[model samples]
Target chain A: MTRIITVALIILFIITAGCALFVPMQKPVEQDNRLFLWLPGASSVQVLSDWNDWGGSVAAGGIIDPLSGRMEKDDTGLWTIDIAGLPGGVYRYAFYVNGYKWIKDPLNPETALFDGRTVSIIMFTN
Target chain B: MSTSLITLIILIAGGTDSTDVSIIPENWVFGYDCLIDASACGDWINNHPVIDSTSVDAAVSVSAVSPEVNFLVTGAMRNDSTSHVVLRRARGVVKWPGTPWIAAGVYLNDQQPFIAGLSNPVLEWGWVDIDSTKGFGVSSGGVLGFSGDYLIQLTSGDTLSQLNVHSPWMGFAGVDYSRARIHPADSEGVDITVNVLSVRGDFRYFKPWLIVAGAEGEEGKWAVSAELRELRPIDTQWGRIEIVPGMHFAGDNIDLPGSAFVPGQRIITLGAFLESRRYFVSAGIKGMLDLSSDSLSSVSASAGMISEGGITWDVIFGYYADGDYRAYVSSTVSDSYASAGIAVEIIDDSTRVTGSASYSPRDDVCAEVSFSGDIDDSLQPECVLAVTTSLGPVMCLVGIEWEYDSSPSLRMNLTGLFK
Candidate 1:
């Protein structure tokens, strides 16, 4: 712990002294408050999970809402959803493609089962 | 606090200028999202089984920064007997976007947000589904390692009220407090008030959480549950192992409004899971005890493995102390363009078997077929065929299903998204 703090302090000092060139580039990580999927060819993508009642599958009439947790597509074929302002809890989510197929988040290693389907798990904090 | 006072405060906050300076917001801003979905399905059942024929749903969500606003409106129409067209799930929220941002949530379906508990949540288990009510919520933090979300909801007749305060985490375990009171809609109805508290923390190696709740002026109107989740994982040369333990106790008259929690029960559970590091194999076993009756409640075990040839097989078995049991087994094989799987399940005195296969000729299109039947002929056999494809900016699906005693069903779906 002491070593870690000392190294952090040294790096802060170097950055403050304008010699921060020694800092190394780090690998990209998954953002805590967002979800991402890359499927440029898919026409639609929605997050079907334990939250939103599995896209309302278990609601009164068992109607599957097509836009429940809908994701946005960018020019680069990436689909993303911003889950900010969500109450902190654990949620199991999977990308529902074209209204049928379920795709788990490849970047997330933790997994859980939701109604016999494998979904990605996230520990969300406000 | 009075509802009138709350309304006045929100109105006052909204009238203030929100363009004071550059916004450092992990916050809402000028944007809009919308989608429309349409589908049709028809089924002929032996008794009376036919879909409403078609359903259409659309939603629009918009946000802005200057006078901070975020709102969503959803409407749906279905074609059927009593074909009802409704504008539901509509919610409007206005934020005073800054530190300690104030916000209000008004929704027809009461999808108001709240923080319950991470593990053994006594307040909310899955989705936030409450009675029809309008709620005011206030939230702050995600700054300086402190965050809190609070909400108060009221019904029109002032017969129902709920309050929730949740602090996710401030470099440690989280805390929660919630209260709910309701007077039945009908005359001569009883009144119930429940207060709950939950605390959960994470340790680097494992996590332990607990919850306790009680209702005022009621005998045995209380419940408590605790669990040590993700506990005791040991790594070895061959694989990894983990075990979790938990227990529950509730009073005879406890009425914890949740979808899955039993109100009159004392139960204990122990579960273990193991995964092979060098091979594609995993196994799990769980046991439950009914402490109230001092008997075994149920036990279940599952195992799965994959072979070098890319063939996967899995098995699950369950046993209950009441002399009921179930067994399931399945195997699958896949290649670049196609995959096939077969499963068998034994429940009660009958066995069921199902087989399914899918072929994806290209990245844009796929077709699938499945069939299921029972060995004892008690359940009529069923078969289904479906195809999915993408057409530029739109995706489409068509499916046909048939059974022994009913006419075939045909279904089609089309979906798209927009800014």
Candidate 2:
């Protein structure tokens, strides 16, 4: 059982790492005024953020409009939302998937807490 | 006259320190926002609601620093149909150089509930405890490596109190535990008590957050959620790939009836994505499982890219086990002077197409026009024209909207901030 667990852990690490060793490591020049999610198999994505009162959960009777902050998906299965018009300040945002799941922006590393769930933070200075 | 005399006495009692009271504070700032919006359309539709409004609000803040205490008092006023003014924040904290401190008057209280997601029982009960309220609290330097700030407050005969204990971050880990309770004014109303502890840890490979929360009001309830997130990513030629997984579970009565909490519900979330350099090419899939129902729940998929020449393109799709689906495709391009985009969305059978364009002469100003509608023979189109500009210290947005079966709505907003 111990040997089996060790082997399983190794496989998990390799899968999570995913070919980075074979290719030269690089950092993508991520966007500051946009959000990205790679979920080609999913049907919809909405950005629920402090900026929009968590997609109006309190005002909309808990049913968030699936189209709010709707990101455009391209042929490559990546979803992107343009937020260039947002004012300069600190903001917390998360990706609401399939109407129920709350996931933070993967590309941004900064995090803050709100309503018990962890969310991604972005600060813009004009 | 005697009531006014009492106020003067109280003012004299508070000015005993070496720093004497003054008529005007040494430093002050003023900020304001003003807007006027109106809509008028040809009287074709009488049932549609139009937007017309004029609003103005301003706030003044005074800050004073002395050897014994620091004071920040703010007052705000607004005018709509009527004009009114109120004291906003009267935060006077005795700094005395650190550790234990005492604060009174209108200060901010941050007592948050430990609720996750839209499960919502917590949200209904947790709400925001009190934002700028008349209260008193005492802070302690440290006790057993944890600092504490205990506070008690009263408003409208209801008593709300909190005991917050937190450990400073040690570069890798930190924890905070808070106990808050509300005693209703009514003799028969049941009191509510909430206890929550949150721990955040930063590891070499991942960051993990754990929340354990419970509350007792009408009944006792408990909830827990764990998340392992990647704060940063290392990429390869095909770009970077990331996976985020989380789990949440709660007692059936997490909130009250009519809240977002569905009884006996549990959710497991997982997502994976890959994006190329500069995110010029990317794809991702994310989904949530309904563990209580033993069902596949809902899932979504998307892919998008921006070409090197600045043309943007994207496609998104989603599906629920209940036969509901939506798909969208769009492309857009922009330059320093002009931009345009066209897109279509299909939800079930209905389809909507949208086209938009914009022009900008300088960095601080832009004007845009857009039109969209369903293409099902019976035309229902919505059109909008808007311009944004900044004049001096104030920013402005003015727009007009004309929609089928509705009167046109016009709006203008102006905002200014100075501190």
Candidate 3:
């Protein structure tokens, strides 16, 4: 019985390790049709875009916007969000990290000069 | 079970758009156990009601933006059949950006009482950077807050004055002031800090600290530093080996409220570390002698190897004069992106074994399993399995555990962030 238990444990360990190494894990974008975006090492990340009035309206002594609610993070310290069903056009956007720190998307290099500051851009088609 | 359900209901009702929720009852308990083992567990167990006691903690972060607000609540049920629910932490901070920084915050914390040898909660409100290079803050409430603990700090170039004044409403009162300066003298870097502490309305103690570090050889390959407070030896590092030695005197009492201080004991420590391209080793010894002539000593050694394929493994061994010997091995297989570790403790004649394994199945999900129990006596071990996953705007955690001589239990937690 002890030998059998040891063998079982070894087999389980091998199987788990093999699955982790060989299996192609599903990407976030592959699981959904929306455009998947990722940002790393951000405590909290939010999307600010022209569609959400650039998150300029101050509420509760801070900026509030519709898109800010859509951002989420995963286990790998990567904040991910999906934007679906948007019209085919150029959209100006930026990311707000930890509420106050703002910057263009580090992953997406496509940027444009907006309001004397650089902002990220995303293009969509029909 | 009913209590947990009620807590969840209260959380849901009290949640707001700015509110964020986190729950980890199982993880919290496990962490508490780890802390108990590291600190004076015997004293803690003896002082607190440990039998049939349950602990639950929850925190909410409100207003994720500038001037953030947070609230933490904790619940505990003692063995005496009495239950208590306390608001452990409530704080808010506001920030302003520019060349001259300005920030303010207010806080009320009551959680310190849960630990052994601590007093009541505290309420404090203060501001900083009222001036560009100088500012003041104030605190009130609690043993640490008597005389409202006025604070004044100044920054000018590489020198600053740090003052902590504690004039509490009752009990011990004192002031602690420290001056620090950083300067470059010739080819070396020098940092000096001097502190004067006065308690019971009298100046009673003084401490001075100095550190000088310099680099030599081409490309700054060799670096050396000497630190002196109570005679710490010089530390020098060249190619691979680094040595450090230090001694501390504990005869004087200059402890600040809310600070952990061990008095009337002298401590000495010496350690060395060596590293090469693919292997590293470290060893250390620490000893403490109290005024009563009682002494305790501990020694530890660790070695590690790193392979070209990114696999790394390490083994550590430690021995204490109190008849405690511990050995641990940890390995990470980068090819599989999995990690595992096992620890064994031999106390007297009995042996205890604990092990854990973790793997990330995907970028968004990870799973962990852990087991702990006596190895020599019985094979009945306590096991726990936990999985965490992120689904768009929501994060979820599920854990199941089978404790020794107890039925299996499952826990689940969910957190959502609102834009």
Candidate 4:
């Protein structure tokens, strides 16, 4: 019985260690001004982070200025807010679709670890 | 003579004083130790350091402790280089039986001054009982994270042995839109279903039943535990319970009955179930009250089992006092019948084939075939085609042959400890 228990423990340790060693770790992401997104469905999506807000009704006028920290509203039916001026720390924001709903950006691929729900990240540079 | 010299050199190296420190990524708990004298420190690795957060930084306070630390680390520290600030040391024993308790510790960064602007504030450490739901944070300008390896110490205590139960607090403020067949068994017309949305919530608690067996020195003693779960969904004014059983049978050997034997709204049920071992088997009893024009009361027992091999079965049986409806039907009708049902589930996990069949002597034979499984954690869709044919002496069905619960009702409750 002692031998069996030892073997079992050894097997468990090996399995756990093997799993840990084999498990791929996530790489540190390069933070940028590209809009973070949270849209789960729907064809087109965009983000509005700490940097920018809506650019009004027109499509071309919706593009936010990078320096001015204006949120972009592109022709892709995506809604965006700007986080360019939000400082060096991490800033979270969502999407504004059809001018009424506050939602996360769908198109942005990178996500924040704080909540499992999707949110765009804006790591500002001095 | 050479071995003696080597041993002396090794001893000298081991006796040197040093400071060792390390911290895991992202979290803010840091572990460190100072060996004023290495030889005197003995085996420093033998000492366990545990840390806990009892509060977060608030507007008025610069540092505090919080009760939400949930990770453990197993690592040692050494003194590398140090000067300046005095290091105050505190030590104690923390215990958690059955499983390793999280070892908690905090090291004040002595060399670097806690400068107003440059100093990255650390969350203060505190002991928190695990029952609190509120989380702690740090003061402004302090880093929002933890460092160091979480160490789990083992202790025998009531906190580790109680059943944790949880019920979800659910609230549905929106309206429900339902569409149904206009006429019984008629597919051509559609009926407007009443709109009702439910507000849901639950309270849950969990306790661990840990088993440890062995002599003091033997590691053969292992700790394993099983958790028990009990859940109940609160009733709402909008909830409805309706079970109407009627039959119309015409054939040789089948006693003559009217075109229909209608006992509307036959029963209402309320109770909870006890599921064991990851829902492999569950036994439950529900109070069944007669709602027909007749007065009847009875108790129904239900048992459901699912095997690891993908076989599923369920049995439901009940004993009830004859109600007014049952008495009326018995006195007025000659060929009346009653029966129970058993359902069996079969699945081919690889091919994504799933099906279930139920048979009742007095009721109808119900069967459904579906293909369901997760393509990914984010999206899982199931499509089932079902049909129920009236068997026995009755060839009549009051409802449409096809019905489905479109929304996958997910009851999320806070209860029971996660193994």
- CA shift at A125, candidate 1, in angstroms? 9.2
Residue B20, model 2: lDDT of 67
- Give per-model TM-scores: 0.70, 0.65, 0.41, 0.17
Best by lDDT: 1
**Candidate 2 stretches greater than 4 Å from native:** A1-91, A94-126, B1-52, B65-70, B99-132, B141-145, B155-157, B187-190, B217-220, B231-239, B256-262, B275-283, B294-296, B303-306, B312-315, B377-379
By DockQ: ranked, best first: 1, 2, 3, 4
Of 1 and 2, the candidate ranking higher by lDDT:
1
lDDT of 3 by residue, B272-341 (tens): 5443322222223333333333344566666544333333344556677566767655444433335565
Q: What's the candidate order when arranged by decreasing lDDT?
A: 1, 2, 3, 4
Q: Which of candidates 1 and 4 reaches a greater DockQ? A: 1
Ranking by TM-score: 1, 2, 3, 4
- Best DockQ goes to which candidate? 1
Clashes of each: 0, 32, 7, 94
Instruction: Say what the interface RMSD of candidate 3 is.
Output: 20.4
Evaluated with TM-score, which candidate comes out highest? 1
Relative to the true structure, candidate 2 has a C-alpha RMSD (angstroms) of: 13.2
lDDT of 2 at B356: 82
Chain A TM-score per candidate?
0.73, 0.73, 0.60, 0.34
Q: What is the DockQ of each candidate?
A: 0.05, 0.04, 0.02, 0.01
